[model samples]
Target: MTATVTAPADRLLYKPEDAAEVLSIGRSFVYELMAAGELEYVELSRRCRRIRRTALEQYVAKLSPQSH
Candidate 1:
């Protein structure tokens, strides 16, 4: 027998790649942000990490407008 898993309708956490897509940036940039403490994430295990939805929202909210 095999079981399949499905994601929730509303996601509370996102993988780095998913976060990058949400932010419209590169995955490597997401990691860089995490490394620089610019982005927040929850470490699930030794090699697993996830970013909270609110964290992503907060990151965008904290961004200053660019001068033209």
Candidate 2:
């Protein structure tokens, strides 16, 4: 039997650690990108931040050498 994979729901969001894993980088790098204004994120509260899938993809695309 074959199993099919399903994508995450639209409302699903990822934290810095998750984004780091997806990008194969260190967690500190993710924060550095955010501090450098390279990655877009939303502040859920005074201390909470969330990164969207779209933002992560855009950041990767922007960093691609071909984009330069």
- The 0-to-1 C-alpha lDDT of every candidate, in the order given, reads 0.85, 0.76
Model 2: lowest-lDDT 10 consecutive positions: 1-10
Candidate 1 error regions (>4 Å): 1-9
**Judged by TM-score, which candidate is best?**
1
Alpha-carbon shift of residue 3 in model 1 (angstroms) = 39
Clashing pairs in 1: none
RMSD of each: 10.1, 6.8
- Compose the digit string of candidate 2's lDDT tens values, residues 1-68: 22222325673567889878877889999999999999989999988888887787677666634443
Candidate 2's error at 16, in angstroms? 0.4
TM-scores for candidates 1 onward, in order: 0.85, 0.76
Question: In candidate 1, residue 20 scores what lDDT?
Answer: 88
Clash number for every model?
A: 0, 0
Q: Model 1 over residues 1-68: C-alpha lDDT tens digits? A: 22222334499999999988888889999999999999999999989999988888788878877789
